[model samples]
Target: MGKNVNFTLLTMLYLFIYIVASPNSTIDKNALLAFKAQITSNPNKILAKNWSQETPFCNWIWIGITCGKRHQRVRGLNLANMGLGGIIAKEIDGLSFLRSLIISENSFYGFFPDEMGNLSQLQEIEM
Candidate 1:
C-alpha cells in the first residue's frame, strides 16, 4: 500500500511540473488577434482569412510569423510591404518572446505603443 502511494505521489509531482512548465500559447494568440483587430485594411486578405482561434499561432509561419522551436512562443513577425494599414496595438507587448517585428512599407498610423518597451527579448523592429 505504501509503495503504491509513493508511486502515485511521484506521478502527481511530474504532472504538476509539466503543467507549470508548459507554454501558454493563448497569450501569444490573443496578442496576435489584438494586432489583427486594429487592422483597417488587408488588401491581400491574408490576416482576414487566417489568424483565427481555430488554428494555432505556430502554424502561421507561412503568413510571416515565426515561433520558437522549444516553447512555441512567437519569435518574429515579418509583414513588410503587405499593404496592411492599421494602428499598432499596445497589446503587442504581450508577445514577450518576440525578437523581430517588421512592418515597413505599410500604412500603419498612430504613435508606437509604449508597451513595446516591455519586450525584453526584442532584437529588431522595422517601421
Candidate 2:
C-alpha cells in the first residue's frame, strides 16, 4: 500500500514538470498567422487547410514552419517553390526564435522588412 502511494506521487510530479516545462507559443502563432494572411495567391493551396486558428501551429501541415528545441517557437520557415505571391509582412520579425528563413523560387515582391533585423537568432536566409 505504501508503494502504491509513492508511485502515485511520482506520477503527479512528472505531470507537473511536463506542464511547467512546455513553453507558451502565443506570439509565434500570431506572427505566422499574420504572415499567412498576407499571402495573395497559393496555387497549391498549401496554407489553406493546414494553417488555421482551429489547429495548433505545430500540428499544421505547412512544410515551411519548424518548431524549436526547447520551446515550440517558430524556428524555421521555408516557403520555397510554393508558388506563393505577395508582399512579405513584417510580422515575421515576431518569430524571436527563428533561425532560418527560406522563401526562394516565389513571386514575393517589395523591399525586405527592416524588422527582420530584429531576428537576433537568425543564422541563414535564402531568398
Candidate 3:
C-alpha cells in the first residue's frame, strides 16, 4: 500500500511539472502581440492595463482572456457586451490557436478577415 501511494504521488508530481514546463511556455511573444494588435483600440482604454507575457496574462485578470491551466496558452477570449464600434481586422488573423471569441452587441460592421479561416482551432465564436 505504501509503495502504491508513493508511485501515485510521483506520477502526480511528474504530470504537474510536465504541464507547467511545456514548449508552449515559449509561445511566440510576437504572435501574442500580433493578436493583441488586432483588437480595436479603445479611446476609453477598456483592455489590458498590465497585459504582457512577463506579467502573466492569466494573472493580470485581462477582461477577455482565458489561459489554459495546463499549457498556459490562451484558451479563449470572451469580450461580450462591451460597447464599442469597429470591425475585426486582419491583425487577428494570425492567431491560429484562438478557441473562442465572444464580442457581441456592438456597432462593428465590415468584413471579417478571410485569414480567420486560418484559425482552425476556434471552437466557440461570437461577434
Name the top TM-score candidate: 1
TM-score of each: 0.82, 0.80, 0.62
Candidate 2 lDDT over 31-123, as tens digits, reads 888898989989999888678777777654556888866666788999999999987789888898999989999888898899988999999
User: Per-residue lDDT tens digits of candidate 1, residues 92-121?
Assistant: 988999999999999999998999999999
lDDT of 2: 0.83
Model 3: which ten-residue window has the lowest total lDDT? Answer: 22-31
Candidate 1, run of 10 with poorest lDDT: 17-26
Candidate 3 lDDT tens digits, 1-127: 9999999999999998767755544452345555556657554556545346565555535567787765566777776776656667565644556788777775566887787787788888777
Name the lDDT value of residue 4 in candidate 1: 100
Best by lDDT: 1
Q: Considering only N, C-alpha and C atoms within 3 Å, which residue pairs clash in candidate 3?
A: none
Candidate 2, run of 10 with poorest lDDT: 17-26
